[model samples]
Target: MDDYQRLVVAQFFESLPNLSPELCHQFVLRHIVPALLPKTTSKVDVQPSAFQGSMSYTAILHIHSTHGGHRIVVQFRTEKQDLSGVTEASCIHGSIVPLVTYQGMYEELFVYTSPFAEGTPYISVLTSSDDFELPLWKKMAIVMDLADLVTRGARANNVPPDTAIVELTTTLDKTQHAVNDYAFQNISVRTSISACVSYVLSQLHNIVTLPLTLTHQDLSPFNYLIDLSTGNVKAVLDWDGALYLPVGSNFHFLDSLFGFMTLKGWQDADDRHELEAAFYDRALDSLAAQGYKGITKEKLELQKAIGMLLYGVERLLKSKDEHSEHYLDGYLRGLSFMKEPISSSY
Candidate 1:
């Protein structure tokens, strides 16, 4: 092959090493080039076959698409074979269980390669057989567990409740006041956010502190997988947002409340409203009962302000995709619930 042809051939081989020359070239021309090429290459149409495997308690499945050409999405399912005498459904992600096989304690949780895509490959339960769906109240219980987990975890890590609250608020307010066209990092929402948050921290200089624990900063439904049968949370996914040390306060409640609100917004005008309210109430009560003594009225008010700001910022950063926009809108409304000053009705 000439120099130009050789260069193209070498590049193609590097893209997908296992495939034969013809197949590699086909994959390249069909998926790679069109994706990488300037607005010139033609798009091809094809769907690749999917592969699946089953181990002791888990099953792995991977789906490929030659046309869409996204990353290989693999799914792991825990088969829970010992369901004979169990009163409730059993789940095994992020749990401290003894290892019975190659899937380590964490492996049972989830680990897979996902390069820029929605719905990363991961484990989920068999929803079809059990017809599993947690009622609103039960779901709220899970949210509360999450909130306490975060609050305790943060305090243990030496994050003063006040600082945590301030930073959290600043991040939110900055995001909300940001103009739509302005980019977030510079003229970004983070600017004003940092300022307000800084002021809050200055005011709450003396709060008792403890060592920090793990903070799952993004505890939204997208990252959490809930077991509907027992009202248990199976896994807390995506630690990418987790932070260590004292950033003042932990922002764990941010996500759970957002999740609660999204669910609330979807309720039917009549029945759904009541159900959603019950869910939110349960979660708030549960958080309060579980030692999440979030300072005073002023602190709580700041949390709401920052929380709303954060929501707006979050919404502004949302993708223009259909599903993304839909979810963002729901979460934004959820954030709204926290914005109001004290109200007799929750």
Candidate 2:
């Protein structure tokens, strides 16, 4: 890259002074080019990346070497880096997770790179009808692939088993405590949402211990890059914050299979009952491998209902508004289907 181009990239981070000129220079030499990242780099170009991460400043590093040109996404973190999270996810779900090519601290900044994925983001398809044709079956296939990965990711870890004897009401009480902690104090809408919570709790009166596992909390459409031609996911991005949680918590992500949220409320897609049922069935089969005592499909669904209730209340806690409240009510009222009402990611 030319000096002027370097200056351009450097100047772009003026509002973020941590990207000092020296740090930018070494980033270009070490990460953008050199080593296995690409051999003997020659000409190059750098531009800001479109991947809008909440915790970092990101850019695209395009390099032309002896063999050919290559592209990598570089991120400078504003928070403590959990670089292993991306590597761990890649170890299991490499097909959908870009492997971290390199990671190091230039000065105090934590920077990492992964091969740039080539495809349309699932979010793009959701926004415009003409981005590409994504049929119902193809979307179903994507959901299955995601479900398989989550189950495998959980089992991949040697998590300590939940040795507590299976007492059903204990789990329900934990839900009640979470509600009292995270969902309480929002007096305006609590009453409106109370019936929904009570009904879910009642359904989950008898249950088994659900083993904890790592969950990709940000399973938004934008994080998934789709192969538009086949309607499959090519890469799952942004794993810096991935951590372990209850296995049933993943049910909240099922909303992405339907549609995304908008200001008018949720703009849902055509009903995919076939896909939805298949996903639940797949979950029951896969999670059963963990062999928690006294587990049953009914108990699993009960846990899902608990997950559904928590999903609503926790979200309500984060955003107390007429719009959020309106959708929270609709979703819990229909917890059997575990439908998502509001768009968490636009």
- On TM-score, the candidate that comes out on top is 2
The TM-scores, one per candidate, come to 0.41, 0.71
Cα lDDT tens digits for candidate 1, 1-346: 3353345445533543453334423443444434434474333332221212222111122223456544322222233222221111112112411112112122232312222222211122222223234355554555555544444322343555766667655654455454344453334234444444444444434332323344444444444445555545554444443444332233323433323223223211223344444444543454455465444433433343344345444555664333333333443334333334333322
RMSD of 2: 6.9
Q: Candidate 1: global Cα-lDDT?
A: 0.37
Best by lDDT: 2
Error of 1 at 160 (Å): 9.5
Local distance difference test values of all predictions, in order: 0.37, 0.61
Tens digits of lDDT, candidate 2, 1-346? 3454455445556667656545665676665566544545367766666544445556778777788878877777655656577878888776578876547666566777778888766766666665333677778778876666666655432433343322334655665565555544335345545444454445543443455566676676778877767777788887766776556665656666755455665545556456667777777677766564344555555555566566665676677665666555544433453344322211
RMSD to true structure for each model, in Å:
15.0, 6.9
